[model samples]
Each structure stands twice: as C-alpha cells, then as structure tokens.
Target chain A: MKQLKTRTEQILATMPILAWVAFAAYVIETGAVLYSYTISFVDPEAAKDVYRGLNLYRLSKINFWYYTQAISLIAGLAVSKAVVAWLVIRALTKFRLENPFTMDMVVRLEKISYAAFGTWVLAMVSNGHLAWMMKETGELQGNWISGEFIFIIALVYVMSQIFRRGVEIQTEHELTV
Target chain B: MPITVNLDVMMAKRKMSLSELSEKVDLTLANLSILKTGKAKAIRFSTLEAICRVLECQPGDLLEYDDGNKK
Candidate 1:
C-alpha cells in the first residue's frame, strides 16, 4: 500500500491506515462496552453510569435479569459492529493498486458487503430489543440505533458490484491482444 | 463466442511452428497460444496484421463468425 506510483496512490495508501484506525476504535469501543457491562454487574450501583446516553444500568433496579438481557443485546450489537469493522480492515489490507482487479478482490469486497448487511440486520434487531425492553419496564431513553448502516450497506454493496464488473473488464483486457 | 480466431488452422496450413510464427510476428509465444486456443477476447489490428503477414493469409482466413450457439 505504500508504493509510490503517484500522489493519488500515495493518498490511497492512507485509506488502509484509516481503516485500521477505524478497526482499532471499534475494538476499543467493544472493550469499553464489555468493561462497563462487567463493572455494572459487579457493582449494581455503578449501573448508574450512563452509556450511549442511556441509563441502562438503572434498569437493574427494576429487574436484574432484564437489565442483564438488555446489556447482553447491546454487547452483541457491539461485537457485530466490531466484526464488520474487522472485515473492512481485512478488505483494505487485501486491496492492491497494481493489477488490482482480480477475482480475489471481488470476493473480498463481496464478503465485506455481506458483513455490513449482517451488521445492519443485527442493529435492527438490537433496536427492536431495546424498544421492547423499554416498553416492558416503562423506560424510554435515547436511541440505540442510528439509521447510519442503511447507507453504509448500500454503498458497500454498490462498491462490490462495481468491483465485480471491474474484475470482468480487467480479465477481458488481459485476454485481449 | 460467435466470432472466433482461426490462427492455428492458418498456421498449420502454412506449416509454421508456434515459436516460428511468434518469432516472425514479434508476438510472445503465450499470446500466440492464447490466440491459437481461441481464448483471446479480442485481437488488435496490428497483431492481426502481423499474423496475417507471416501466415500469408487474409483476415477472413484468420477469423471466422459462426451463427447460432456454436460456442
């Protein structure tokens, strides 16, 4: 990725670095969520710590099991997002500037798109779970799901399609005299 | 493909080895193999000209179009 063919490609190499940073951020966020969840269980009073603008730990006072369930759902969503971020990092690392269009790249891009779609689905499920939990215990707080992933999924899916076509065109070009 | 390369047929008729044709045409053996095997997606006018010149064949002799689902 550090190859210096042009200024544009030099800038392109920075994309992988950004993706790695994003991946690290997601990993750290996942760790923080898990740490908070664990701390909340150890000290029920610490459940008062607000996370994602939601006083989810307060639910522990109403119903301990339900609070655990809510926290678990949130953790699951976090892990799914981290997985998606890791997939993005993997795709970025595998990407090549020289002879970039290949079947391998198409497959990796497709995998990343699929992973993003899965994350979106998990986000929807977690959003529904949070709503249901709030209704069951009469606690409506901040939003757990931002409508961000729809655009992400669409963009990545479209990128994968473009890469697939690129692979086809590159193959045709290589085979042509 | 409906359109196909017939480089091997003309090569055989001219009694030229792939390497000999490649040397005369100044094309790589691999490219000549691709054209001969009909694996090439397209041929350039320059390459077709070189092959035709070496094989003493017309473009029609080096390429053919078969209607229907022959491929």
Candidate 2:
C-alpha cells in the first residue's frame, strides 16, 4: 500500500509537465501549418499593394499575423494553467479524501477553490478579444453562441472546484502528519 | 469532537527532552509542539508510530479522546 501510494504520487506530480509538453507540441504543429499557409498561399504582391494603399508597413502584414498568434498563444496558456491547476487539485483531493485523509481540510480547500475559480472565470472572460480571435482564425469555427461562452465559464469553474478540494486534502494531511 | 495529546507524559516517562524527541522523530520542534498541544487537525500513522516507538509507548498512551465539550 505504501509503495502504491508513492508510485501514484510520482505520477500525479508529473501530470502537469506532461500536459504542457503535449500542448506545446500541438501549438507548434498548428503554428507550422499557419506559417506555411501565409508564406506559400498569400500573394506578396497583393499584400504589398494593400499595405501601400493603406499607408501601412509592408512588414505589418506578417507582423499582424505574428502578433495575433502571440496573443492567442499567451491567452491559451493562461486558460491552460487554470485548467491544469483545477485538474491537479481535484485529482489529488479525491485521492486523499478517499484514502480518508481529512474531511475538514478538503471542505475548506474546496470553499477557497470556489472563490478562486470565480475570479479566474472573470479574468478569462474579460479578455474577450482572445476568444474573438480564436473565432476569427477559424479555430473556434462555430457560431458565437451563449453556450460556447458558458462552456468556457464552466471549464474554469469545474477546475477551480477540483483545486479547492485538493488543497483541503493537502491541508488535512499536513495537519494529521 | 475533542481530542487530547499526552506528549509531555510520554517524553517524561522516556526520560527524553523535546529536543531529543524532535531529533529522533525527524520532525521540527515547532511541529512536535503543535502535535503535543493537540492543536493539530490530524496526525499521520507513521509519525505517531515513530513517536510511540521512541517513547516506548502505544499511540493510546500519547493520545486520548476528550468529549466534555465538542468544538
């Protein structure tokens, strides 16, 4: 039982790192695809003409694409952090709770997580342009429905709850130990 | 639920000081103090066992249930 517990802990500890690696790989692949599209398919002459007519920098065309990509990347990372935090917390809490770690700590942590999640949700929502860009870039290729927005809100909410519960369990363990 | 700890009694019986107990148990004096005071919310079995073994007593000797007033 002790060995099993240690092994499980080792795996859980590595989960966030693993998640980030997978996410990074996906982002790189997507960036490569977009880069190829812009370079190979977009007519440089047409872009230059448009830039000249609008008195914009010729480099601005490529720069805009890069800028938007950076924005999306940063935004995606923020959301992912919140999501991962929520997941890890939830998993750890559930594991400890079922192991009969401590109910008091788990309950208290969950309460805190609820508030944290609410704050995270608001922060994400406030950056509305990020989601809009995802839609503009064909990433969020669906209609801008209320359900979609709610889904984002729900995702953060659920994750926060998980983290809160986990914290409670950890606190309980600390106290007991 | 009210719980009580008897760390001082065990330490006294074992002829061990808090510093010695703290060193033997691989726990900080601060944490040992917390457990001794019954202010800690929980205790790990391993830690309890270590304390008991070092003190030459059972867990029951170190901990007791107090039900006069539940908090």
Candidate 3:
C-alpha cells in the first residue's frame, strides 16, 4: 500500500507542471487573440483580412454588449484556470505522502473544486450565449461544457471529503498512541 | 479531558527517573514524557502493565478522574 501510494504521488507530482504549461499556453493564446482584436478595431480593412484568415471576422462584427460579454467570459475562464493551476502546484509542492491528511490538502481540494465548478458554470453560460449569437448569425457554435470538467469538479469535491475523513482518522490514531 | 494521567506522581513515589523508567519499560523518553505530561491520548495495556510493574503500582495510581465542573 505504501509503495502504491508513493507511485501515485510520483505520478500526481507531474500534474501541476502539466496544468501550469496548459495555463501558460492559454495565456499566450488569449494574448494573441486580444492583440488581433485590437488591430481589427484600429484598422478594420486590414483586420478584416486578418480575421477572415483566422475565421474570426464574423465574431469581430458582434455588438458592443456581446463583444464585452465574450471578452469577460474568456477572461473569467482564463483567470479561474490560472488560479486552479497555481493552487494545484502549491498544494502538490507542499504535499507529504507520510502525512497526507493535512488541513492544507483539504483547503486545496475545496479551492480546486470551487475553481472547477466556476469554470463549468462559466463555460455553460458562455456556450449558451455563443449558441444564441450563432443562431442569430446563422452559424453553428460548438458545445463548451465538457463532461471531463464536470467529472473533475465532482472528483475534487469527493476527494476533499475523503481528505476530511482521513484527517479525522489520523487525529484519532494519534490520540490513541 | 477529565481523565488525567498521574504518571509523574507514581514515578515520584517510586523514586524513578524518567530515563530509568523508560529503560525499565523499554519505551522511549519522549513517549514516557508524553504520558507523564498527560499529552498521551491513550495508553496501551502492554505499556500500562510495564509501567505498573516498574513502579510497583496499579493503573489507577497512574490515572485519575477529576471533574472540573464539580469543583
């Protein structure tokens, strides 16, 4: 069991790095998109050609409200993803296999769950808005609320409860000498 | 919390030092200190028996129930 736990910890140790890389990639992509949008706004003709090449010219023509909403949605998702990645990295760095049932782990699990849930809700709402916008424009919008994200949220919540129980058991065992 | 360890009292009565008791009982000083200082949550029967044998006292001599609210 101890060997298995160590192996699991070793595997999980890489997850934070993966998450951080994903977050960095998302930031870069978002920055490029924002830069493109800015150029499009500054020079519509030039931007139109650029956007057309990127297949985002239709989105560039959206109303002010929709545009702001889309930006806010993207920003929200990015911020939450970054926060989750940061927390996961911090938690994993501090994690000790010898004593895994700490309050820090519980807090980290709960925070991760909150971030996942927030991401799920934001994705669902933003996807709905996108679908509505697409219907108005006679375009098809892809589904954004993924089952994997929902599963992650649920898994984190369950893990948090499990950690809570582990903490209780550890305390009892310690008290028992 | 109402049940307190009287390990110190028993050790004192037996004129046994912590180290001596530890060596006799084949337990660590830290563990004995924990028991003496009433920090131990529970004592194993084997440990209790060992301590009792060394101190020449019963388990009751090393443990006491004091109701703070009654006082």
Candidate 4:
C-alpha cells in the first residue's frame, strides 16, 4: 500500500537542497576567510578595506604574533565548519523518507556527529583566541566568536543517537514474523 | 535467542511446502522463510495461530526452547 507523505517528510525531501545551499555558503565563507588572511600579507594596501572596512591588514601589523594567531584560529574554525557542512550534505543525500531508518543513515548520522564534535572543539579554540585578542588588541570579536558550534554538536549528537535506536527498531520490525 | 524455531520439522511432518504454508496462512514467502530459518525476532499471536491452522500443529510443535542455542 502506498502511504501519503506527511508535511514533515515533504519538507525533509526539500531539505537536501537547502543543505546544499548551506554547504555552498560554508565554502564561500572558508574561501573568504582564507582570502582575507592571504590578502593581508600579499597586499597590505588593499587589506585595509577588505572585511567591510575592518582594516584587519593594519590590525595584524599592530601585533603580528597575537593578531596572526587569532586569525589562524579563525581560519581553522571556518575550514572545519565547512567540513561539517559537507558531512551534513552527505548524510542528507543518503537519507530516504520512505525508509528513514537504515544502517546507512545511522552510519552517516554518526559520522556527522563526529565531524560536528570536531568542529565544536575548533570553535572553542577559536573563541578563546578571539576573546584574548579582544582584550589585548581591543578589537571586537564580531562574528568570529563561534560558541554556537556547541549547540550544533549537541543537536547532531542527539540526532545520531535517535537514528541509531531507529535503525535497531527497524531491523527488529523487519525480522518479526 | 535461545527460543528455537521448529517450523521446518513441523512442515515436513505435515507434508507441506513453504510456499503452500505461506499461501494458506496469507503471509509472504519471505516472512515464512525468515521464521523457518530462526532469524525472526518475534512472532505475533495471530501469525502463530494462522500458521498452526495451516500446518495442523500446536505452537509448541512449531517452536521449542533450546538451552544450547546461545545466540
């Protein structure tokens, strides 16, 4: 018998495209961070107005070790976040609403949780560096503070646990006679 | 996992094929195969009743508790 999909599954079907869009945004963000870092060194004159008039190029020169370390941490966090976004896309691609609970989906969810955890760690490190820089350099942390990654990690970890149980239940149900 | 299925023995005694039993019980052949191979995690009472009715056997005849079956 064919079952009509609920509104949630219908939305789930559309979520993959949204996930891809998010992935693209993350890629763009990583590229922007790397570009800003490289431009600060390659063209000191141009770096003054790159980040919406932040003048991070001149900021780096104020104290090279502190500013550069904070910048590197920011870049690392961006790259790790992009990796997490890519993992989310992969998990969404493997998910099927018709058969939502499968070993493959469970494995993918676990992988996403792991990646998210790694990203969260990187976020914590970046946040610490940025916080210290804010104190010394008096520069605002702005959006560079990534404390939000902890929430993302918790969400994905809970989802993976639920999916693991779902896989077990589905297996038991299929084997029932 | 120690609960063992004796469906094959019961079917042989009743001179019934897996397909015949599946048809009489209105269950899919794959489901019947799963039960016969002892891979089934559970059996519904209605399903056991239907299978017993088709094979002319008791639930005890179709299933057995085996101590040696650790898995």
Candidate 5:
C-alpha cells in the first residue's frame, strides 16, 4: 500500500507538467488553424486550393458568430486547462506524504474539479457547433464529441469528494487523542 | 463544551510542572498542553490512565462538568 501510494503521489506530482504541455499543444494547434484561416482570407485563390484539398474551405468563409464561437471554445478550453495545471502545481508543491489530508488539498481538488467541469462543458458545446458547421458545409465526418473531457471532469470531481472525506477523517483523527 | 478538563488544577495540586507531567505520561508537551488548556477534543483511555497514575489522582479529579445555565 505504501509503495502504491508513493507511486500515485509521484504520478500526481508530474500531472501539472503534463497538463501544461497539453494546454500548450492545444494553443499551438488553435494558432495554426487561425493562421490557416487568415491565409485563406489574404490570398483566397491560392489558399482556396489548399482549403479545398483539405475540405476546410468552408471554414475560411465562416460567419462572425461561428468564428467567435470557435475562438471562444478554444480559448475557454485552454484557459481551464491552464488553470487546472496551475492549481495542481500550487497545491501539491508542498504536499506531505505522511499527512496527505489537508484543507489546502481539499480546496485545490475542488477548484480543479470546477475547472475540469467547465472545460467539459466548453468541449461539449464546441463539438456540437463544429459538428453543425461541418454538416452545413456538407462535410459530415461524424461527431467530434470528446468523451475524454467528460471522463476527466468526472474523475476530478470524484477526487475532490475523496479529498473532502479525507479532510474529515483527518480532523477526527487529530481530535481523537 | 459541557465537559471541561481540569488538568491544570490537578497538576498544580500534585506540585508538577507541564514538562514533568509530559515525561511521566509518555506524551509530548504540546499534547499535554492541549489537555491542560482544555483544547483537546478527546482523550484516550490509556493516556488518561497514565496521567491519573502519574499524578496520583482519579479521573474525576481532572475532569469537571460545567452547566453554564445553572445559577
């Protein structure tokens, strides 16, 4: 049990780094997509060929509403992911293996859960909008719903509850003797 | 709390210092201080027994029930 706990802690300690890397990748991908759209606007004839071949030419002419929706979706998801990463780093930086049940841990877990839930909501809405846009453009490539986001949100919520219980038990134990 | 710890009174009656009581009871001074200051949520039977034995007193000597509403 001790070995397993240590291993788990080690993994948790590395999670902030992984989350930040993922967030960075998401930002870069969004930037690349936006750049491609910008190129299509600046040089329609040349970029049309590229967009057409890629079957995303329709996206180049997307209206302001759709464009803003897509941008907001990307920005919201990125911000939430970054927030989770930052919270994890701040919360677990001084974690003690001997006494893992703390109010600080509980608060951090709660915040992470809220951020993950927000990300899941944004992902769900964005997937719906994207799917609709694709269908409108006659490029229905199947739904883009991210089950991973929902799963992560649920997992974080459960972890928050677990930490809450841990805090209660720790309090009781402290008062026992 | 309705139940209060009178450990300080007993310690004083026994002419014992906090450190001396802590050594005799095999508990840390901080913990003993918690008991002395009535800040402890609960006390273990073994700890109570050790303290009672070391101080040469009964449990009743170290605990009191305070009814605030009583005249």
Candidate 6:
C-alpha cells in the first residue's frame, strides 16, 4: 500500500536508531553481568570455580556458555542487519532515488543478501562446533540437531529470494514506471 | 504520435482557475501545472480519475492523440 505520509516516514526513519539503542543496551547489560558478580574479574580460578559450580550439570546440561554466547552474537547481528536495512530504506526516500534497482539499492540489497548468507554460514558452522561440544559431554544422542537450525537454513533461502525479487521489482519499476 | 492535454478546454468549460482545480483535486498547483502542460513523464490513474470527476469529463476530454506534432 505504501501510502506513507511525511509524518509516517519521519517516524519510520527513527526506528533503526531506536533498534540500535536497544541492541546496545543488551550488549551493555551482558558486559555489566560479566564484570560485577563473577569473581573471574580478579581470579581466573575463582571464575572457573563459579562456572564449574553452575555447570555441575555439564554432563546433563546442553552446551552451556557457548550456547549463550552464540545466541547473543546472533541477536546482535540481527539487530545490525535491521539497522542497515532501515538506513538504506531511509536514505532511498531521502534522496528520492528512482527505485530499488539503482546502484544505490543494489548496493544496499547486496549488503543485506551477503549478511543473510554470512549469518547462515556462521550459524551452520557454529552448530557443528556446538555439536562437537555436545559430544564431549555426550549430549548429542537425543537432541543433537535442533529443528530450528533447519528453519534457519530455510529462512536464508527464502530471504535471499525475497531480496532478489525486491531488486527485480525496483528495476522493473524504474524502467517501466 | 504524442498525447496532448486539453486542460484549456476543461478549464474554460468549468470556468475554473488552475488554483481552483488544484484545491478541488487536493493536489499541489505545481503538480497540476505539470500535468496540464504535459511535462510529466507519467500520471497515476487515480489522479486522472480525480481530474475527470472534478471536471465532469472523460479521459478523452482531457487528453488526445496529436500525431501532427511529431517533431
């Protein structure tokens, strides 16, 4: 429908900054947690003891801290992707570029496409790494593979197509309209 | 052949000024001028419909083929 008025566009333009702020807050929170409670600040041995105590269920628990770090990394990356997308859309509107097919849109979409592909690759490889860690603790027998991983792979394919189609639409719109 | 605008005829029949037509159609006068002078590369069907409704005319009344003006 794209009946965006001036006021709406202004608000939409601010959304990416808001997302960045929120993502930064999570990063800061994680940093704060690492600094305050874990005696790992002054004594590596003490930190190891604390982690070992919590990871007492290392045999039963899933790949512990590695999983948490991976999730946070993926989340931060998702936020960055959103920020980039919002910026490109805002810049296109601001410059009054013809459509998505111009050099500008191509570059923007390319960045998104590459990011999506790279993230999928990272996730897949990290899943392998996680599988290895899980095997060390023998947690791979029951839930070695997450169905969500398959979903993520599928999402990568779908999004790549979507990004490609958006480019095509922009190109056609520019040429014909 | 090129499309020719019949803005003068519509304006005369309605006794409407460009400003009046702009207000009636809720479009900027500059945009209306662009359409009137055939300077615009494209026009939305909605805009054409609005113009037809406000002027009580058909698309043929506002636009015509001018093959003789091919220069």
Each candidate's fnat, in order? 0.77, 0.64, 0.50, 0.91, 0.50, 0.05
Off by over 4 Å in 2: A1-145, B13-15, B69-71
**Which structure is stronger by lDDT: 1 or 2?**
1
Score candidate 2 by TM-score against the native: 0.40
Q: Evaluate model 2 with DockQ and give the value.
A: 0.46
Measured against the true two-chain complex, the DockQ scores of the candidates, in the order shown, are: 0.78, 0.46, 0.49, 0.82, 0.57, 0.06
lDDT of 1: 0.78
Candidate 1 per-residue lDDT over residues A113-164, each given as its tens digit: 8877777787788788778877898864544557786897788778888888
- Report the C-alpha lDDT of model 5 over A66-130, residue by residue, as the tens digit: 54455456556656666666676676675677888888887888887887777677767777877
DockQ of 6: 0.06
> In terms of DockQ, which candidate is stronger, 2 or 5?
5
Clashing pairs in 4: none
CAPRI verdict on model 6? Answer: incorrect
Over A1-177, each residue of candidate 3 has an lDDT whose tens digit, in order, gives: 889978898788887788779778667656655666567567654334332244445555655455545555665666666677777777888888778899889998898899878888888888888778777766433435664679878988999999999998887677553
Give the candidates in order of lDDT, highest first. 1, 4, 3, 5, 2, 6
Ranking by DockQ: 4, 1, 5, 3, 2, 6
RMSD of each: 3.4, 10.9, 3.3, 3.2, 3.8, 10.5
Q: Comparing only chain A of model 4 with the true chain A, what is the TM-score?
A: 0.83
Worst 10 residues of 6 chain B by lDDT: B34-43
Residue lDDT tens for model 6, A61-174: 344465345334444444444544554454445433223334554455555556545555655665676577566655422112343655654564565467567777654543
Cα lDDT, model 2, residue B70 = 52
Highest-scoring model, lDDT = 1
Q: Candidate 3: misplaced stretches above 4 Å? A: A1-10, A45-56, A135-143
A92-148 per-residue lDDT for model 2 (tens digits): 545542444455444544454554455455445534644665555533221112324
Which ten contiguous residues of candidate 5 chain A have the minimum total lDDT? Answer: A46-55
Ordered list by TM-score, greatest first: 4, 1, 3, 5, 2, 6
Model 6 misplaced regions, further than 4 Å: A1-11, A25-41, A44-102, A138-177, B1-71
What are the per-residue Cα lDDT tens digits for candidate 1 across B1-71? 88878887887898989999989999899988998898999899999899888888899998898877656
| Candidate 6: C-alpha RMSD after superposition | 10.5
Q: What is the TM-score of chain A in candidate 1?
A: 0.83
**CA lDDT of each prediction against the hidden true structure:** 0.78, 0.58, 0.75, 0.77, 0.71, 0.57
